[model samples]
Target: MAIWYTADTHFGHENIIPFSGRPFRSASHMDSALIENMWKVVKPEDTLWIVGDFAFGPAAKDMNWLEMIFGQLPGAEKHLVVGNHDGELSQLLPWDSVSQLTEVEDNGKCNVLCHYPMITWSGARKGALQIFGHVHNNWFGSRNAVNAGVDVWDYMPVTLADIERRARKLPINKHWTDVEQRTAAE
Candidate 1:
């Protein structure tokens, strides 16, 4: 079984438009494509790590729909690290429905898992790496971390090998370049 990490599916976000230029007119269109693509690469025994933003808005009535969609996914286990759009999900979701966020140290590597990216670079200094989602376009560098976001949602998912080699080099400092600061200020 392989371990996969992906985030920002935004399953029910009818407003979502892929950055890659693909067109999705409704949430159903996005949902079907996401699930089909995910299952195409996911084995029944594989584990999926969903970083955050599983849902679109702040309504608890949609829990049934959420569960139905997630239940249909093919995986041995699914873990969710809460994101900003988690909303009332934390309470309505069953205990077994989602995995709690925590720091993990495995195979001589340290990593922090969270929905929001932390500002500190403690993970790298401690010989750990942080895997996160949030900034969709910040997928560059070697040691820094950011989620691939739904805009670039790839059903194939990301492997640890890819994360280590690519995301590790991202800038760890909070000070953004003039371009970055301007984008954030917008």
Candidate 2:
């Protein structure tokens, strides 16, 4: 099965439209577009790792609606990594696999996946790639890391091989805290 990664969908959360400067006119529109974009690449046999923030605000509390949405989406092996918004979901949702961290090995390379961007993770110095979300695109990741959130990837899931290829093209992040401070000030 093909593998994919994405995070911070925030489905059914209306405030995200304006707060994140999303182009959608409403949450429903955003949700439709996100689903369409996701299914375009993700097939039934694929595996999609939703790193975190699958839903938020009102959406997170609506168990029935959330489950319906999951059912409607293409049937891929769905894995979850808990994020700040995903705290409630981690305990209740019935997913293929759910955790705060997951490790993946592809093309002889290992990737450490998580919801929040970390300064250091398992195998950081050994050249393992860190795939994360929660910062969107404001904070550039470390040399061996990359943001896997939809906001940085045209609002759709990205493949591991693609993430690896792109990470290799970026320059190393010299000061992690400095980048955090700059993004906060913006």
Candidate 3:
């Protein structure tokens, strides 16, 4: 089974269409497109890593949308790193695991996974990669960090290898492990 990563889906958030300039005709269209496009890649045995912002709008109303969307996804297993939009109700959703942050490995490279980006992560100094979703495609906070949100990746989950290749092309200076401490000293 393969593994994939994605975030900032905002499934039922109608405002996202205009705000993000997505071409969907409506929230329903956007949600349907996302689900259909994702199934083209993901399968029943694949592991899907959703970084954050899976849904939005009223708590009770959105809950129903969340249930339907999650249940329809083809992935056999799913992991969630809660985003800003996720609430206490998120705990009620069915997923293999949920957390604010976690670590995952692809081949020989280790990656720090989170809903938001960070300047330095657990193994930043040693070349561990950072995979995040909150910034959408608007920003790439650090060199070693790659934004895995759908807005940046054609609205489908991407593989770890895809992230690693993109991360490798970022400016070398942006990945400096000491940037945080150096900024604080300044």
Candidate 4:
């Protein structure tokens, strides 16, 4: 089964549309599109990891509404790296796992997952990749730290290969040199 990752969905937050410059006309429209986009690539057998900010606004506070949205998530196993917006109700969803930070081994490579991007992470000096969200469209992330937010990734979950490919083309993080050994290229 493949592993998929995404973050900062802000599913029910109406204000996010205007604030983040999202293309949706309304929150409902954005939610539907996000779900559709996820199902397009994330199959039932794949594992889906949402780094943070699963939902927000009035809808998120309702147990039934949260359940409805949680039920619609397309994945055999869902994991949540709890974000600031992920309230107690969001955490109550039957997730496979939930935490503020965790390490995942995808394609034999270690990936440090968190709600917010970090200047340094576990295994940073050993080639581990850090995937995070929360900044939304303001940043696209650096070489070693990649943004997995939907706003930057066409509002869809991405695979590890996708993240790695993007990391290679992006500029290296300035703080990378401070935490890790300097490479000849840098």
lDDT of 3: 0.82
Error of 1 at 164 (Å): 1.6
Estimate candidate 4's alpha-carbon lDDT, on a 0 to 1 scale.
0.95
Top candidate by TM-score: 4
Candidate 2 C-alpha lDDT tens digits along 121-152: 67775778889988865754667788888777
Tens digits of per-residue lDDT for model 1, 1-186: 777677777677665455434467667877788888778877899877777776674332487887777776767877777777666653355423454465655445667677676644455544565677766544532345555454544544676676776655655545423223334544
lDDT of 4 by residue, 28-147 (tens): 999999999999999999999999999999999999998999899998999999999999999999999999999999999998999999999988877899999999999999988999
Please identify model 2 stretches exceeding 4 Å from their true place. 89-91, 175-186
- The TM-scores, one per candidate, come to 0.75, 0.87, 0.89, 0.96
RMSD of each: 6.8, 6.3, 3.5, 2.7
The window of 10 residues in a row where model 2 has the poorest summed lDDT is 176-185
Q: Against the true structure, whose lDDT is highest?
A: 4
User: For model 3, where is the 10-residue window of minimal lDDT?
Assistant: 173-182
- Please provide, for model 3 over 34-139, each residue's C-alpha lDDT reduced to its tens digit, 9 standing for 90 to 100: 8998899998899898899888766325677578888877788898899998776664689899999999877777789999888778887677888898877687
Judge candidate 1 at residue 93 and give its lDDT.
52
